[model samples]
Target: MSHHMTKNHPDSPNGQDDISKNDSGNPTIHEIIDIRLSRRGLLKGGAGMVAGGFMSMGLSACVSDSSKTATTAKGFSLGFTAVAKSLNDVLSVPTGYTASILYRTGDPINGATPAYVNDGTDTAASFDFRAGDHHDGMAYFGMASGGSGMDLNNSSRGIVCMNHENINQQFLHTAAEAGVGFSTAARVAAQIDKEVNAHGVSVIEISKAGGTFSVNTASTYNRRLTAASDMDIYGPARGDTLMVTSYSNAGQKTRGTLNNCAMGITPWGTYLTCEENWAGYFKRPASGGLSAKMATAQNRYIGSSSSNGSYGWANPTGGDTSGTGLYDRWNINLTGADATADYRYAANTFGWVVEIDPFAPASIPRKRTALGRFGHEGAMPAPAVAGKPVVFYMGDDSRGEYIYKYVSTANWSSADVGGGLAAGNKYLDDGKFYVAKFNSDGSGSWVELNIANPTISGYATYAFANQADVLINCRLAADAVGATPMDRPEWTGVNPSTGDIYITLTNNSDRGKTGTTTGGKSRGLDAANPRYYSDLKGAATQTGNVNGHIIRIRESAKDHSATTFQWDIYLFGAEAGADATNINVSSLTADNDFSSPDGLWFSRAVPGLMWLQTDDGAYTDVTNCMMLAALPGTMGDGAATTITNTAVPANGNANQTVATIAGKKATTDTLRRFLVGPKGCEITGITETPDGQTIFVNIQHPGENTALADVASNTTASFESHWPDGGNARPRSATVVITKNGGGLIGS
Candidate 1:
């Protein structure tokens, strides 16, 4: 899995647009104010760690230090740091370990299919059933042998379920080389198919022996779920008129899932993959032809044509007139006889948490509508409690969106163990979705999204049509209920040991801006999102809640279904040299400083060991994206401290902090940088064996350097990153597994 192999086109200064030219100038006054108030309250009020609370909890495993020393205790050794220059570079680990590519873009998983050519020309038919690209969040589920959940010690064969976030056009096609100029309708179709194939999850069986792991290519469990695969629609929105189509007369089923990002596995053995950035994959007709209501919906969801035509799928066939059915699907226009006859079905299909059974190859993944959808990042289930309902936490990954929780209607029972579709029918098909609203007094309420609730039914803000509309347009529903908007809520990870939920609020730049505010939208900061500062180095260009922060919520009764909870900020992202007065919240220093925290996962085997990975561009000038492992204490670490940003006068509270292990300075040792990635590579999608002996991580989009010509030889060398290539070579986005040579637990 070399980064070079992932490049479909040579590096060039005039590369495909990266910053999403879709920017409609600055956000509208309403959008700006909505984001401003949400961020202000989140950071300033609700997110502070209580200083002295966790001390008596017996979690004092370490103290701060000034030197870089590998503190080893209880047989666990702090692993060596691996350096990667970019997304294309190969992984570098400690001397005793080795790495391999278990899977990559276009890898066939059905059977005797040819290996991926590592070029951009793979056939679309083949990709219709193959693994997707930009692998993100993933989980490793040990297979059950002769019934009961596989014995933790005897489990040698397991299913590796990984999410294919999005596609990289430069690495997937050769538009420039094919003499087929990029952006044409035909060119866009090819790119669309390639991306559509690469957007779901790949479930492959993997085996480990002699301290090394490899894909069991011939295993029956190996499966690839592409965007074309038919999936069942479940929950309140299922079978609704909004989802009906000629393709699905029942209206309870959809064609496929797209933009599948981070994922989670339920205790019952089902995989939950989320859809993020799904809005960018659709294309609405130009403004003049659309109704005002329809136009507003289209613009609100996807954007205008200036947004690049939703991957160009509508181009080749006829630019919405392409008679070819394949090309016509991407054209989200209303020209057909009716909504069912046109691509309106496209909008109805995406944006839900899809459930897949890795063991059932013939099974169609189900889009669980019960979990209200809107840029779903990941779904983490709380440890199952006997007789109680299953609680799953999720985040809507967008600036000024809300966090959500789904409580299954069915109670937990041992009979549901390994129950497959039946279990999903019993639990996932019906559930209550709730949104978080952190109060100023430190307590929070999970407002139920039920149509029967007065807050929802009697609300005068946004119309509460029905449960279907609520789930389909969850952001609006959350806004109506006054759910606290967050700074790009990305991933949510539940501590297996404690039911505490950790959410990554990847930076939001719209906060603090003032303008004509819309109904139900506030204009200042509050408790949940409370920081506003300009990066010192690029102050002129950057503003708002730039660095971002991690928020942790503790349920009052340790019950996932509990509506009330306490909240705090685990850590505030900033540069090492940030001014203590404004920037430093947890009092962080050089050894561990980060920004735009994205991918987050908590090890089931290692209770206190939480892993944090970053996908960032704002702080790239100082350091590349990274992954850190933390031995975090439970909630209540810092006292409430207000954060005041002159630009946006918001009130923010500080979270609890302890001495850093790297330096005796008072900070949050509960979070620390475990690994740093190569240049331009986002360190994400991590999984480890149940024993914690083997770990697998994805290094995505490595050599994204901005300059390089079409020359095959020269363009490859221009990018400074060559990851997974131990000897200064081209980088490739691939998965690498790190295990101890002596066959011991990782990070131990």
Candidate 2:
């Protein structure tokens, strides 16, 4: 969803393009100028942290020197100084590190296809054989050779699967020079075909021959699952009446998966690629008057949009199927009268957690519907323990949506390691969906979303027909059960060392709206989602948790499958210039303050090494989105702080004045900004080999804010930043490998 913050693409004639999946209603939050720190406080705090001033230099040298490098009390450490915050148009890293392009958009999956020309002329047919754009959540899996030279955790030969969230249309064709729109109907149709082929996940075989990793395009393991690939639908929702469509009459299959964002690697060796922000791709006619039930359900999942879609593929003009070809199926509104007659039920087929067997190139992907369907972010699993149920923690990824957990009905067994979808059936097909409810006492409960629950069964407005209905309308069901609505929840990660679960609650400007606080129309701040403040970034005013925060929960006794858990706010994002006590809750200085914590991962290879990434809109005025490394402590390591609101009117439209309370805070030594990305890009999708020497990270849509007119120009000066492929090349979304200077483990 970070890509949503960028400028709209020129070819998007519909203006239906939405990068921030959902918009905040209040849009702007009021900042209290009265809360400013006094002269002495300013000299000692926030502004004093900035360099160049005499006292600041003295304070910076003495106070921050001890915390500048990433070091853990447990003894593992980072010797490099934090990467300097940069306005330069290139990737920035610590001095000893190096970054190289490993794979990029349109890179071939086979040797038969040549390298990308970077000039928008790559053929549409060739796209299916190429890598895709906006690289996101990915994973590296070791392939055991079972011979003399290789072991179970072999670092040399492995597979890398990446989620291609969506396409960057501006870079797809020869500089949109004559105007941004297409020149011909044929060109438009062909471009749409290419875009569809680039909208899912890329599975490439990578091998290290002379200590340098490269894509094995000729390897049979390389494959792509684009928007047109055939896929199977699994779980109780598989053949449900609501899922039947002309594309899959038996309700067992669907065509393609789109808007793939975050991901998870299953214990069975398959990869779970999540379908995110997928609803915008479909065009549903308002006049269709789809059933009351269908309308309610569809709205809950996809929400509502004004345009047909970013691309009018479903309702294209000219001769393809006379506007009713395989592409026409994207329009989900009623057309042919019955469910199986047309693609009226097409939208239901997506918004799923698609499972891909990275090892089996020919195996079709399956949509595990039991994971529930909202704007899914990622499906992060806790470690699989023998005799215990496998658990996956997930976030809904919308403003004020609920966090969730899926507990498998079946117990875990090492025997199912490579079982594939059959393993999915035994473990994922049936599970208990639970929503989180944080209480005042620093404890929380997982409110079950079971169809039989009284809260769901007795809900009068939205009928709960079955378990499938509850999962299909998960947001509605969570609301019906009174689950806590948090700021936008994105990625979830489980600490490999301590088993604490952490979720990135990206900024939500809608949280403290006129009538949305606790005593008001909507939910208010709780212990887990404590601070609710406004951010003022150059003339722009953003309120209601504008900088976002990360919350970590330790399941009861560290049992991942436990129903009740104790939670605390691990870190709150803020600007280095903001009020230290109010916004800079984590006590951050200019070196590490960040906003919109999006991608997070706990390194399995390097214990205690956690990587934090930013896909932000709030802090762009100060710096580009960045990636950070942290040595996180388990839950309850810091004291809880309280929040008070003085601007509340007696009418109770906003947050009312409340007593100060304490909340969880991270130790300063725990988190530090490791790398900052280039201009107009988000730092996302991270993976490292088992040995922890090579880390793969994605830099998405760099130079994305350039004007369409600039994009169409002949001079390279028209671009915001030509990066990765420097010297006038169009900015391309790519994955890079980060290696230490002399083969030391990452974050060391």
Best by TM-score: 2
> What is the per-residue lDDT of model 2 for residues 267-340, given as tens digits with 9 covering 90 to 100?
87789999877777776765336567676666555544433655666754564564334776777867787988
User: Largest lDDT belongs to which candidate?
Assistant: 2
For candidate 1, write residues 468-577 as lDDT tens digits: 87787666567566677677787888877667889988776655455313322343455667665655433434666677788888998888899899888877777766
Count clashing residue pairs per candidate: 79, 9
- Per-model C-alpha lDDT, please? 0.64, 0.72
List residue ranges in candidate 2 displaced over 4 A. Answer: 1-70, 145-152, 176-187, 304-306, 319-324, 516-523, 645-668
